[model samples]
Target: MRQRPVNLMDNPHADRVKRVAQLAGRSAVRNRRQQFLAEGPQSATEAIRAHLGFLKLSEPAQQMWPVGETVAEVYYTQRLIISHPDLFALVQQLPAHVFVAETSDQVLQAMSDAVVHQGIVAVVNMPPHSLQPSPGAELVAGIVRVQDPGNVGTIIRVADASGADYALATAGTVDIYNPKAVRSTAGSLFHLPVYTRVELGTFVASFQGRIFAADGYGTRVLDQTDSGMLNGPTAWLFGNEGQGLNDDELRLADQRVAVPLYGLAESLNVATAATICLYSSAMAQRRQDPSTS
Candidate 1:
């Protein structure tokens, strides 16, 4: 038999409820606590699965704490309990260390950052700074000083979907854990290692691969660029939306590559450009070694 959810939390202003709500509105609270809010059913489901996966890891692996310490607490409305019974069932499978609770609609609204809370939210621990891309990573997507939270999250999603080994945000980039950003990821954040607050110079030095800068005024066109160059390990750098890559940032890349503009459209959105660049590399890499596909 499935265990019933805890009693409803009806007070929107309860101390505990307020603290969770603050995570969405305040960066200081999140940084100090090393936690962020995963709003909606999609994020909540992924967070729960990550926590459960953590429990199954070997003792030594668990010590590394990669994805296991992900979900800290989950709060859902009565409607969610009934509407997403499957999700609730997954929540029931969580061990005693995880907190699961039922909340009133008003309490859920107060706890959520989104206009539509989707009747669920999970408090997720930020992966430790020590967490990094796997040693043998073949393709990586990097964004430098990209201020839009939505773009950051979307790029992470694209990187995951395109089968890139990992994603990263340079120090000046927007917070990947921002509520809007987290919502935009659509749960891909849980699928891979996404390093944040990284330094571009250090990242470039650490990789033994070709680096391509996605620039509007580059000498090489993405579609026309040598396929052989992208067949090996590669890292892509996407710059800020408005200014693109600065002179210094562009100098770090082995090549500045531009996605060709077929029509009168001014330029592609950073996320859209990333989709093309990453997919191109993914396809080339898979062709080079079918086993990786």
Candidate 2:
């Protein structure tokens, strides 16, 4: 006989519901709690997988896990449990520390920042900021003071797709955990290591490889830069959307590389520029060392 699932929460105003909703709007709350909301089916699914993967690690490995326990709680509407039984099954695999609850549609809506809640949300723990990339990391994508949450998230996704070893959000960049940013990641948040609130100068000082600044006015155009330069470990730094990299910031990079523009468009979006620069480095690196591809 199949056991029926019960709705564990029905009140939209419940304390638990409000706590989850607060994570969406308040950075202070998120920082103090060290948790953020992963809303909608995709984010929830990826988070669940990350949590389960963590459980499979050996004890010592678990203790050293780069991204801490990925999910702390999961809330889903009855409609979702019925429509997404597979997702529900994955939720059931979560450990005892993870709170799993079934909520009414209204309750789920109250807990989500999305206009359409998608019937699911997961409270995910933030990864520790202490794990710096190894000196051998092949590629990294860094954003400095990029204000748009969507652009930040999209750049993270593009970095993941291009096989960058890590994504970095320097101080003043929009919160990567912002609901819009999380949604824009389309689950890539769980795919790669994303370090936030990094210090640009500190990172530049510690990084062993070349740092390429994505500048609109640079001596070296990206397409014409020496392929050998792109073949090694590299970090691409992108700046704020409107101003790009300021003079002082550009001085830190080993090279300033511009994406050649054919059309009359004045500039490329930060995320778009990041995609081009990252893929260029990724393809070049893979071509040089096929084993990494």
Best model number under TM-score: 1
The C-alpha stretches of model 1 lying farther than 4 A from their native spots are 54-68, 133-135
As a whole number from 0 to 100, the lDDT of residue 82 in candidate 2 is 80
Candidate 1 residue lDDT tens string, 56-163? 433323432345477788888878768999888887887666678888888999999888679889998877666554435689999899999999999999997998
Clashing pairs in 2: none
TM per candidate comes to 0.93, 0.92
Tell me the deviation in Å of residue 124 in model 1. 0.8
The 10-residue segment of model 2 with minimum total lDDT is: 58-67
Q: After superposition, how far is residue 87 of candidate 1 from its true place, in Å?
A: 0.9
